[model samples]
Target: MVFFNLWSVLQWYLRPFIKWFLRKTTRLCELQRICYGDKPGAERSRNVEKSLMLSRTRDVKQVVSYLDNTVLERSFVPRNFPEILNPSVAIILRAKKINPKLHELFIVSFRRCLAQIWSYRLLLEEVEEMRKTHYDSSLPEHEEKLLKLWSLLVPNEDLESRVTKQWQYIGFQGDDPKTDFRGMGLLGLENLLFFASEYPQASSHVLSHSHHPKYGYTYAVVGINLTSMAYYLLKDGSAKTYMFNARQYLPNMNLFHKFYCYLFYEFDKMWIESKPENMMEFSIIFKKFENAIRNELADPASVFRINIEVDTI
Candidate 1:
């Protein structure tokens, strides 16, 4: 902790001098040089954010805060992400006096990088709000989404009652799923619903695997477990590598659910292949699975494509 604090203080003092020297020698500002040097992906986005944020310029710092604030309200739309970023990107370019016409490529790359960077912030906000929301039997909206999850996963049959043993068929520990949702909250339900609705065939396949006589595990519980895993990965910013590199996925709740689907599908494959003796092995296997994901997330180039690998579509 002491070392980190000193390092932080050192960077605060030295960064401006380094930026000035780089600007003088390369005839490029920090942003230009970073975008120019790093390929257009996670690494680039990460550095661009760090560069702008570390900048002493007020406008550059404001750019990040503005983007952070943009996602907080209900009015924020994914379609308008780029539209909103245009002026902020302009702010950044103007901060260093870079001409948009002269640096057309830079402008394009910077905007894409910003989209990936800030959309991630939006995801963190959304995840926080969802995780904090407890499953309530009283709220109709919560109950409706919970019922919708059941319908999505078990469409051929109707749930006999709101609180019954049927919940265990989907992997809940008890008849009342409300109790099981204590940990991950609505985020778990949302992730499960996304897998069922968006990738129905794939989700069904994984759900079927949960009932394997020898290797069977609880489907919904595993999903909620994976949601807890996903929440930490996203929360810690470890997911940026996959999130930023997978440019096809707009950073939104769907993108997050898409990530959860990958974990669920992969875990099913792992569990069946490993052939663990019983549920007792679940804790060990789940830990290994999470570590494996963390390892994948370590690579800035790692990308996710659950649709390509598992979706029937």
Candidate 2:
């Protein structure tokens, strides 16, 4: 027994050798040294480098422009406010003027995007609560305090599960929200992952291709550039008031869509104005906007949209 124990200890001591050998085998050290500086920062820098590379792999120009034009630009729109531009009644009024099928798709996509954004707002609230918990301990209880504070630092596994499984199929038991969602009667996970992966190379690939059951949905922040810009502009602006006015018109607007429409309108207006009279300047603005959406606001669309089928259920 003693000999066996000693041998185990010796093997344990040599475990470091095994790790070093594996890292060497993987070319990790050389890769890290080349990708990051030679210091503790190497790991941190490597992680960030990987993250940035993943973020940039997408052709996100259009996405970013939409974000910037709607969310970031200062002069024209309400910052942080939802842009309500559905014009459903207007759409109905002009149904003959526009392609009904295209309009229907737009409405469906827009509503789904809005629902996803609503979830985002809840996410933001959780984030803010977490931030508050970190900075302020004035909450009534320690549990509440811990929850709010640590929320920002940690991922909300519970919330992730809730949103992911909200509209799951009747008998579906898979864990991943993206793959498990039975709505749209999607044909397995391949196409869905392909569609979303376009905006983020690494994440899109993982969400679309990863085989792990638990590693279901990638929480990609899809509309953040616009959201960030909207918040910035609406910071003490008239968007809140304007949105309230628009809401009077949308009795059927879900809370998610209500705020979303307001936000969308804000950006659409801002982008239209900022669109340069000259083609070159317009192109530059468009490019910057795309980067912001593709890189900065890496939101997952699978979780964002409201499942119309679920609304009735």
Choose the strongest candidate by TM-score.
1
List candidate 2 segments past 4 Å from native: 1-97, 101-103, 118-122, 135-138, 143-313
Candidate 2 lDDT tens digits, 1-313: 9999999899767755764685568643322332333222213223323322333223223332344344233311222333432442233214223344544543443333332322333333432332233222233453243233223222333334423442222112433333332321111222223222222332223223222243222222222233334333233221222222232232121322333333333333334456444434534654565454334223211112222332232
Give the clash count for each candidate: 0, 32
**Model 1 segments beyond 4 Å from truth?**
1-11, 74-83, 307-313
Give the lDDT of residue 105 in candidate 2. Answer: 44
In model 2, what lDDT does residue 120 have?
Answer: 32
Q: Which pairs, if any, clash in model 1?
A: none
Q: Give lDDT for model 1.
A: 0.86
Q: Taking the tens digit of each residue's C-alpha lDDT, what string does model 1 give over 1-313?
A: 9999999999889988988898999999988987899977889999998877777788888877777777776434667865687788889888899999899999988988887877788789889999999989999999998899888888889999998999898899999999988899888888998888988889989989999999999999899999999999999999888788877765788778888989998999889999999999999999998999999889888887775656653
Best-fitting candidate, scored by lDDT:
1
